[model samples]
Target chain A: MLAESLALSAVLFVIGVVGVLIRRNAIIIFMCVELMLNAVNLTFVAFSRVYGATGQVFVVFVMTVAAAEAAVGLAIIIAIFRHRQTVNLQNINLMKG
Target chain B: MQPYYSLYYTFPFYLFGVIAIASALAFVTRKSPVTAALWLVNTMFSLSVLFVLLDAQFIGVMQVLVYAGAIMVVFLFVIMLLNLGHPSEIADQRGRWPTLVAAAIGILMIAEIMVIARGKVASRFQVPPDFAAEQMQQYGAIGTVARPLFNEYLLAFELTSVLLLVAIAGAVVLGRRKDTRAG
Candidate 1:
């Protein structure tokens, strides 16, 4: 069961990664990042089942960090959209310099 | 009989795993950011079920409340705020090369796990007898996590709050109207 949960988490993580790599939209990329984080959280909880409550404790902290990331990330996206008038990555070349 | 019982028991876990993976797939393939966010929320709900199945009740609830509730709402709000409904509906994919590379990478990862954890998939679903149940009985659901959060990890917990505060301030600063800024 542990291995299965880990496997599922791995698959989900891979999907998030593919999403991030292929998707052009900034918000979708952030959502994929969140999916990756959630996959890690699942892995932690699965291990917690075998090891102890420490895994659960770590899951809480992961949630905290994810929330913080969301707040800051979405704000960055909003700001970029305001400046560039679009959220498509190909159009934004300010960082190319 | 033993194998069937294990399969029966692990059925719900697999069900949820399929739901999560499918929703995640949907989330990435959609054209509209709004629909994608909604699908991501579905993925979150299914994962929450998996968390509960794994016995982390508190984390499970937090998964729904924090990820699905607060974060997704914020995502949709940003999408709507920017009027990203129709005009900004760009292509999900860039081109053929990136898609091929992504597929290769994903296959490599899943294959890595399979090779490393070979022959163990048959006996994989159950938690070690009572690791979490014992803790749940002693500290209750939330308290099991709360004790660690308050004691050994207290400093980290406090720092997360500080991090959230900083994020909030940063968001406010960045989200302020450009017209109002003199610079």
Candidate 2:
């Protein structure tokens, strides 16, 4: 049963990764990153069932960090949009090497 | 008979699991950011159900309150601030290579997980019989989680608060208007 849950988490994480790699919209990529974080949180909680409450505690920290990332990331996206007038990844290439 | 009660108990896990995966797929595929955000909320709600099923009730409630309520609202606010209409125009403009690579990576990950699940890698983490029920009775759900967060993990908890503060300040600084003269 736990393995099944872990497998589900892995599949979700993979979907999130695919979303991040393929999607060009900055906001969509951010959302996909959130999806990946949630998948990891699911894994932590599933493992917490076996190892006791430590995994759940770690999940709390993960969620806190995710919240912080979302805040700062969205702000960066807005800043870029302000300067470039577009959130498309291809166009926002001022730092291109 | 293979214990009919176990089937009843495990059904919701599978149900919520399917809901979460489906909603997550919807979230990533939607053309409009607003629509995608809504689907992501559905995914969060389903994951919260899964957390409760795992006997982590406090985390389940926090999942809904923080992820679905607070974080998603922030996402929607940013989406609106950007005023991105007609997402179809900007959606998936990067040709076929990214799609092909993403699919290949996803398939490889699923295969790896299947191998792990089918092997001894998953067996090492087995829960002792009655451990979950005993823990629930001894500490209750919230108390068990709170003990570690406030005790062994206290330093990390405090650091998260500091990180949140820094993120807030950085967001304000980055998002403030540089000048009102041009408008």
Candidate 3:
């Protein structure tokens, strides 16, 4: 059971990594980042199953931090969209200057 | 959790695991951010059920409430508010280098999973559940978590609230705009 759950988490996290690599839309990339975080949370909960509730506590803290991150990240995305009228990462390469 | 594994536990565990992976695949591949966000919600729901299967019931419920309910909703709201549903604008095919890198990472991860699935790591780190069971008997599941959270991790917990306050303030400042063009 432990191995299976960990394997599942790994696959999910890999998918998220691939998403972040491939997706052009900034919002979609952010969503993929959320997916990666969720995968890590799953691994934490799975370990907590064997160790104790300490892993679960970490999961709770992770969720809180993720919420905060989402709020700020989306707000930044909104600001960028307002400035450039698009959310495509390919097009938002202002750092090249 | 049963002392011994049974088909009952194994069945739902695999089911939710499959659901989570599939939904996450769909989430990443979808063109429209709105549709992708919805798929992410499904993935989160399946992950929540898997959490319950792992005997972390409170964490499971929080996964549903906080991730599937709150976070995904915010994602969808932003996707819509920005009018991001135009699937055509998104270039669905990424270049060859990213595809190669992603494949390399995926293969490496699969190899790691195969090593873990060999059952050696599981046997070594598998601590007896006596400590957690004793705590659960005393404080129940949620309380088992809460006790440490409010005691040992109290400072960290308080700091998390402060972090959230800063996040909220930062979001408001970033989102706020001066009057320029009337929408």
Candidate 4:
């Protein structure tokens, strides 16, 4: 039973990874990253259930970090879009230097 | 008997697995960012259900509340503000052999790790008689998690608040529109 949960999380994480690598749109890529974070959250919860309270504590902290990451990441995306007028990501190479 | 055991647990796992996979497929195939965002929300909700089945009720609720509720609202706001429909021209992804190869190799490495881990877990799966009942009692409610989360992890909680504050400030700073007015 628990193993099945782990399998589902793993499969979802893999799919998120494929989305991040294969997609060209910056917004979609970031959404995939968020999916990966949610996958990790699922794993943390499963392990917590398997072991004890410690895993749940980690899940809480992870949720906090995920929220923070979303705020900062989206802000950066918006700024980049404002500057370049597109979120293609490949077009923005100003940081390559 | 085997079917009963499978039905008892594996059914929910399979159900959520299907939801997660279908939403992911929709997310990837959809051209509109808003459409993809909606599918992503569905995916998050299904993942939360899997968490509940795992007995992580606190995290499960947080998954729905924070990711599906709060964070998704922000994602949708950005998608709407951008007004991005579909790309006017399909971005050329051809001739990116190296990147594709790298991704395939990375995936293979992860698969290998999972296979190894599965072996380890299978070897350790000697069932104690009361294990199932005890697990049910342990995860049947969230009170067990609340006590320690507020106690031993108190400092971490404070730090998270600080992190959120900084994120808010950073988002405002970055997202504020720059005016072209002369000084």
Candidate 5:
């Protein structure tokens, strides 16, 4: 069952990676990144159960990091949207060398 | 074999698997940001069930509380606030070579990990002899989880609090009203 959960987590993470790579939409990409974080959370909890309590403790930290990430990422997204009027990644190339 | 065996075991097995895969696909395929957000919620719900099955009861509850509850609500709020334009038709995903290469690498890496996981699973599925409640206590009960959580791991926990504070500060800084005259 642990193995099954880990596999599911990995598959979800892979889907997220693919979505991030293939999609041009910034919002979708952010969602994919969240999916990836969720996958890591799944692994932590799974290991915590199978091995010990440390993984769960780590998961608490991971959740904190994830929440912080979401706040910062969304604020940047909003700022960019205000400037460009669109969230399309390709069009926002002001800093491109 | 007991009549409830399949009900207790196999049902969640297939249900979580299907929900995880289906929601993930829907998340990637949907054009509407709200639709994508909804599917992501489904994925989080399914993963929470997966956590329960793994025996980390506390973590399972937090998975629902934190991921499914707090973070996702924020995601939905942003989606509504942004009022994003229609997702561009997933244009033919040009430059196929790089995608193909990445997918192939992913498949190979997953296969390698699967081979390693198989051995661990085989050992885990075997049942151990039943023990009395006293014996279970000797090995430590759920209290063991909290002991370290509040003690040994307290610093990490405090750091997380600091991390959240910084995040709040950053958000405020980013959104602060700029003095237009300075520019």
Candidate 6:
């Protein structure tokens, strides 16, 4: 059962990684990153069943960090959109050097 | 292995597991940001169910409250704010090379997880007998989680708050409109 859950978590994580690599929209990429973070949280909770509440504690921290990342990341994305007028990655190559 | 309890317990796990994976796949493939965010919310709810099945009740609740509730709302707000009208314009522009590379990396990750799942890597970390009963007796669910957060992880807890404050400030700063007249 644990192994099955862990396998599912890995699959989710891989999907998130693929989303990040293949997607162009910044918001979608950010959502994919959130998906990856949730996958890690799932793994932590699964391990907590074996090792106790320590993994759960780590998940809280991960959640905190994810919230912070979302705030700062979206802000950056908004700022970028304001300047460049587009959130597509292919067009925002100001630092092409 | 009581048939009734085993069947009852295992059913939801499998159910939510399938829901999470399916929603996650939908989330990544959706061209519209709002639709993608909605699918991610579905994934988050399914994961919370999985967490609850794992006996991390507090984490599960927090997953719903934080991930599905607050964070997803913020994402939706941003998506609406951006007003990305044309989905076709911002759709995936990557060539086949990225797809192939991503597939290779994903295969490597699955292989690594397969080894671990097969108990070839770490067999010593098996769950102790009556772990659920022992944990319930020792600290209960919420108490067990709170003790570490308030005691051993006290400094980290405080630091996380500080980090949140800084993040808030940074977001405001970055998100503010620049004064063109100042230059």
TM-score of each: 0.90, 0.92, 0.92, 0.86, 0.83, 0.93
lDDT of 4 by residue, B1-183 (tens): 122355767788788879987997788667778788899999988888887777666777888899999998998898778877655553523247745864796478569647955874454654554553475576556766776778898888888889999999999989888884243
lDDT, ranked from best to worst: 6, 2, 1, 3, 4, 5
Across A42-96, the per-residue lDDT of candidate 3 in tens digits comes to: 8888777677788888998999999999999999999999999999888898899
Q: What are the per-model DockQ values?
A: 0.73, 0.75, 0.74, 0.56, 0.50, 0.78
Report every candidate's CA lDDT. Answer: 0.87, 0.87, 0.86, 0.77, 0.74, 0.88
Say which docking band candidate 1 falls in: medium
- Tens digit of per-residue lDDT, candidate 1, span B1-183: 122237656899999999999999998898888888999999999999999888788999999999999989999999889888773467657799999998898899888866875655346565566657687889887888888889999898888888989989998988888889996
Q: Which 10 consecutive positions of candidate 5 chain B have the poorest summed lDDT?
A: B127-136
Model 3 chain A: worst 10 consecutive residues (lDDT sum): A45-54
Residues A1-97 of candidate 4: C-alpha lDDT, one tens digit per residue: 5566676677678778777767778888888898888777777776665566577778778878888998999999999999998888678899899
Candidate 3 interface RMSD to the true structure: 1.6
Q: Of the candidates shown, which would achieve the greatest DockQ relative to the real structure?
A: 6
TM-score of 5: 0.83
Candidate with more favorable, higher TM-score: 1 or 2: 2
Give the runs in model 1 whose Cα sits over 4 Å from its true position.
B1-8, B116-129
Tens digits of per-residue lDDT, candidate 6, B79-174, equal 888887457767664789987898898889888877867764356666665675587579988998999889999999999999999999999989
Q: In candidate 3, which residue ranges exceed 4 Å CA deviation?
A: B1-3, B113-126, B180-183
Chain A TM-score compared with the true chain A, each model in order: 0.97, 0.97, 0.98, 0.93, 0.94, 0.97
**Clash pairs detected, candidate 5:** none
lDDT of 5: 0.74
lDDT, candidate 3, residue B148?
Answer: 84
For residue A14, what is the lDDT in candidate 6? 91
Q: Is the docking of candidate 3 incorrect, acceptable, medium or high quality?
A: medium
Question: What ranking emerges by DockQ with the best candidate at the front?
Answer: 6, 2, 3, 1, 4, 5
**Against the true structure, whose lDDT is highest?**
6
CAPRI class assigned to model 2: medium
State the TM-score for model 6.
0.93
